[model samples]
Target chain A: MLKKSGTTLIEIMIALFVLASAMIPIASIMGYGGRATSKDARRILAMQLLDKTLRQMLQADYDEIPIGKNIQNGFEGIALGDVTAGQDKGFSFNISLDSEYVNPVKFKYRGVGVNRPTFKADSPVGDDFLPEETISLNDVVIKLTVTVTWNEQQNLPVSVSAMTYRADFQRRTG
Target chain B: MHYLDAKRSGMALIIVLTLATGILILGISYINTIRKQSGRNTIELGAIQADLLAEGLTQIAMLKFKEIPGPLYYAYIAHVKGNTSQPYSVYHGDAILGGKLDSPFNAEFRTTFQLLSSKMYQDMNVKITVEVEVSRPDGEKYQRLIERTVSGSRRPAF
Candidate 1:
């Protein structure tokens, strides 16, 4: 009347069930972490692209910079491989160069004449100073913005941007 | 027969306990590694943001410089001509241009400009330094300094 020497079918099934249950939560956690890491990587890529494009725009001549927003399919020179039309590795690039007039700073040459206007005037220079000259300083400054966006997992949209002013003292379109 | 059945059940229980402990330890370590990686990523991103903020602020400072070119040029001339009083602060003060940050990025900046070369009749070469202090919602703070040399020539009056 010896009993069985090994685990019964019921015991084995219970063990398997416990192990499977434990692994399920662990698998989900790992999956979540993997997705987060991927999102971080894509964000980094988008940031780099935004920075590079912004710098390029800064270097361009102010007049050469096209005013108004322009959108492109994707970034170039990044070999992410085989992107479909209208999307480059699931990223899009946008750039805008906007120009606006700035208030003129009225400056007066403190003398009776234009040349060598620095002389100490006999009369109050404030009253007898040369006519205030208005220089169009706004033409030299342009607001440049570069942005990159991508659809993350679950169709969640993420973006990175860099903006700065591009000034060209030589070109005065105003 | 009872003794044999009890022995088999005990061994099965021991095996299951050991496997469960091992799996838990592995999962905890894995989670810990992922957490550390995420932290590092956040730090890297913050650094990039700080750098870009500093640079953008520098550009704004340059625009500020451009705005007062006439006054700055005259002040430089006066300083060179034995005027002991330097009127730089009158035209461009500390924090030349500030307070233009967009949402989600909190930063404060202090800007200072030094006249590197004021050679007569030459463009005034100014050294602009921008100091930025950035604070993120995640309790991370970063400070950055950026220096740029810009040549300022007074624009002709139209």
Candidate 2:
């Protein structure tokens, strides 16, 4: 009876060994999946923050907008201290503006005008190719770039950047 | 005694097989869940990209309007042709202008403008609508629409 029981115990041990061998790879795969999902979530959040900042900059008055780095926080409504209280809690962003004044006449005259063969009164060809009206006021084109940075699951740094241009033009009445 | 030993070994084998199969199924389910989640993320990203592209295109259209001499004439022509209600394809290509998303995706933009009645003879009310569509590498599509009314003094050239 003692010999029989020993043989049964050995069989159970072998079965457990096979089961454990299969589990390690499965567990690792799950871990990898978890990490990937977390990373994607953080990336989406960063993109949202960047988009918000860009829109705010575009809506602001051209004269009111400030130039330089770290002028506006990406999170407008959220408090900075609250966002930075804990580790990996939130994100930070910086907005920078580059402005250049363009002469409408110089810009227009430089273009080589090519009349489209299929031009119709109602259907115009590409606007880029069309002759633009000369603006009385010099055009101030502002390029705004917003960069957002955040920490991932393992404190891995991730960043997203977006850029847009705002043209400062107002109609002049005689 | 031999038969009893054989029966005990058979039961152990069955238990192991069951445990292994269960683990395999669990792993597969987890993988499927992850795949679905990843797809969702891709769709979300595509939507956001489309929105940004639409916004950028609208700004471009506005800039173009400002540059053109006869903004009201163009708006009136578009309205007369009934194109203002429908989207008119302006640009279609894979160019990443001033926006995020480093990956080059297919982009198409359509614009239309309508002329609004104004009390001031010099001032013209033009409502421009822009639509942008972006396609992801995975064959997913997203679209966005934006409209803005721009009122400005008409140039004499118009």
Among these predictions, the greatest DockQ belongs to 1
Pairs of colliding residues, candidate 1: none
Docking class of 1: acceptable
Model 2 chain A weakest 10-residue run by lDDT: A105-114
lDDT of 1 by residue, B1-158 (tens): 67766666755556876897798788788878877887776666567667766775676567656555545555544455555223444444433244435455777777766767665244678888887777767889888898999875545667
A25-80, model 1: which lDDT tens digit per residue? 87887787787777667766666765666666556655666555543422333222
Minimal lDDT window, size 10, model 2 chain B: B85-94
For every prediction, compared with the true complex, DockQ reads 0.25, 0.24
Which residue window of length 10 is worst by lDDT in model 1 chain B?
Answer: B84-93
Per prediction, fnat is 0.15, 0.25
Highest-lDDT candidate: 1
Per-residue CA lDDT of candidate 2, range A1-174, in tens? 888778778878888887888788888878888887766666667666667666776666667655555443323332211133123754443333333333431222112123556555445434423443233434455556556666665666666555555555433323
